[model samples]
Target: MAPFEPAALPELLPLFYRRLFPHGPYGRWLGYGGVVKNYFQLREFSFTLRDDIYVRFQSFSSPQELERELQKLNPYKIDIGAVYSHRPQEKELVFDIDMTDYDDVRMCCSSADICSKCWTLMTIAVRIIDRALVEDLGVRHRLWVYSGRRGVHCWVCDDVVRKWSPALRAAAVEYLTLVKGGAETVKKVNLSEPIHPFIRRSVGVVEKYFEAYALVGQDILGSPESWEKVLALVPEEHREVLQDEFPKKRDSMQRWELLKGRMERTRRQGTAGKSAPCYADWEIMLQFCFPRLDINVSKGLGHLLKSPFSVHPKTGRISVPLDLQRLEQFDPFAVPTISSLCEELDAAGDDAEQEEGGELEPKRRARGRRAWRPTCGSLSSLWRRWNVHGEESCGGGVTCKETSEASLPPTALFLLRGHCWPQASWCLGTRRLQPNPSAPLNPFPPFGPFLHKKH
Candidate 1:
């Protein structure tokens, strides 16, 4: 494959939308099984064209029409907006985490640039936030997507989540956020007595990566300059002691031990200031490595977010859904670019023509034949899951249709009772509904209008 050139995006985008774009799945995801009258049509799409031209409030009558418009416009970047009439009722609960937020603590990269070492911060963010969403908030459906550049976007699509008010959304974000304040604040994280379980769990997630990420890869205490920043987070009483002790240590790990010892000894002796002494270490860990969120993105009802599968204008990388099952091994650099995918299709077409003993056809015609087809392995996997929503028969004259969160892994996407029913169908838009015998009983016991049971 030839090198990805941002300059050649105009030529490459047409071919990408023609051959590699997964229109069927993209349509199904946004359509939401026609949950409301004109739901898909009410939602807006914004397109950024060549020369920085941006078109907004573009809605479609159907997914088919949307695909045609995409092929025609060949947008440089696609941004999805909220449904016009739905207000806070229809939009997904979204969260944005950019690497730029970590500039203060990030040692390897800053701004738009990111490296594997710094990428660990993203992995940690996903793990910590995902756990809270699932275990704490009772969210069963969430889609995690790479931003195609330096961050990740999470869309929580559970029925309850979509109806969350702006205040509720803000509360959820507040629960997840720990590192606070701006560049001027010397101490970003402050803790009170008896830390919450959610925070304790977040600290546990950070602990696994803190040593490798902060102490070693970042070398947060390797030099006096960096160590001073670390000292600022601790109690004032212990700062001078650690300031002298850090230089004598050999590495970050040793320097970290010196700081920890000072704090622990101070807490035991009750010599610390009015601040909570016992929580100092946890505060420092969180202030350095916790997920830094753009709170407005999560709380606002009409915020425009870059659409998944949209080609980033600068990087040419597809904003693909992430498979969290293999999150640790995910490499941002390995993501396929539009230029690479187009070249791949060209190579595959040549091989096919050679095998058949026929002359190669024009690139447009060759690729056009594969339009709406999955071209690469990751994309193919995404397509298969998305295609599941089109209606797959579950035998016994019942067809299973995934209406929402179709991009989630099988275990998350399909779980009934305690077992993994691969062909499980959602309650929405199903013609035949046979109640699973082993399904857990509803705890509400069929009560009032607010807590009535499903018939």
Candidate 2:
């Protein structure tokens, strides 16, 4: 009888009902997981209002019984439905709508209280949709009231555009989806100065909305101009209400300014000249620079290197710098190599047995202990040996040193025992000196058909 006051309706209730029956009464209902329904005879459509002002229908005669019944229903668990159109004698047609599109439409107010966060989100949605319809799609769209007892709905029926392809629909959905998580994408687009004209226009609209909302003390929306107009229509006394309804304008501006400053700093530090690095880039860089090291980059370093340092501007070769500072954090030379250590040991001393016992023993033994030895010829084996298992010993208490010494090929042993340089000419079996002056010592011994003496 009070003209069905819109302001009195619970904000979440309309969204709940819409989710339950999106396609109308004819839609197929998907039952809630644990909800139970009971049939009751009702003489009138009774509205049972809770303390939060959320209304529900009940056949119970007393308030105590209604309250008791309400306690059983779980508000978080809700029923969902799909709308299907039935044509007599024709195949049933279903509207395949993406439910994610509704995520942008948030509850602005709960019961009678104003939700600043939700209101801010709703304002952004309104502006985003408005910009998409007017600029991108070039279609006329209008905001409609769902009798205020329900949530507001936007009707996008412009006679010029009837049906859209799936791709086009997906794009529309993506555009709407951006409004939900605030202006993150918008900020990216703005910073990069996107080449797409439509996107640029949308970005401008979003910026304007943010500015206008701040000016009027309202929750920042996606379109500044539209909100200014909305502000003009609101009564003066209600203007003060915005102070409590939205984030402080100075605080919001400070955040935006801080972000912009960081971007500028990135550009100045030559990071923007290379590839646009995200927070993940720094994370990966930190991991690579210090493999086993765990240390937070100083705020000064973070500020200086907001983006990953790149080698080329166009190609953008990204890698952590292997300087002294970074190397100090983690031992870069800790990556062991058997061949290099063997070469070093040979250069330092002539006899392996002598090297193992003398002053050089400690160094050679340490090298032998850390050196990686390959067991299999496969690349997978190499990766497993090098990365998965570090310096895995083949024999008990002997380490890879003993295993490598034992497995040395005959030719390699000849080269080692003869005191012949790895590149010098030498024969394996007789320990005979070869006459050929040009032949280099091959690490593999000649077998059968391959046994040709170098002339």
After superposing candidate 2 on the true structure, give the runs of residues whose Cα lies further than 4 Å from its correct spot: 1-120, 141-143, 146-151, 165-168, 179-195, 211-252, 264-455
lDDT of 1 at 92: 83
Question: In candidate 1, what are the lDDT values of residues 166-253, reduced to their tens digit?
Answer: 8999999998988888989878888875669999899999999999999999999899888877887877766777777777889999
lDDT, each prediction? 0.70, 0.28
RMSD to true structure for each model, in Å: 9.1, 33.3
lDDT of 1 at 132: 93
Listed per model in order, the count of residue pairs whose N, CA or C atoms clash below 3 Å is 0, 3
Look at candidate 2 and tell me the lDDT of residue 303: 11
Q: In model 2, how many backbone clashes occur?
A: 3
Per-residue alpha-carbon lDDT of candidate 2 for residues 183-266, written as tens digits (9 for 90 to 100): 232111122332355444544544544533342343323244433333332334433444244334354444334334444444
Range of the 10 consecutive residues with the lowest summed lDDT in candidate 1: 443-452
* TM-score to native of every candidate shown: 0.79, 0.27
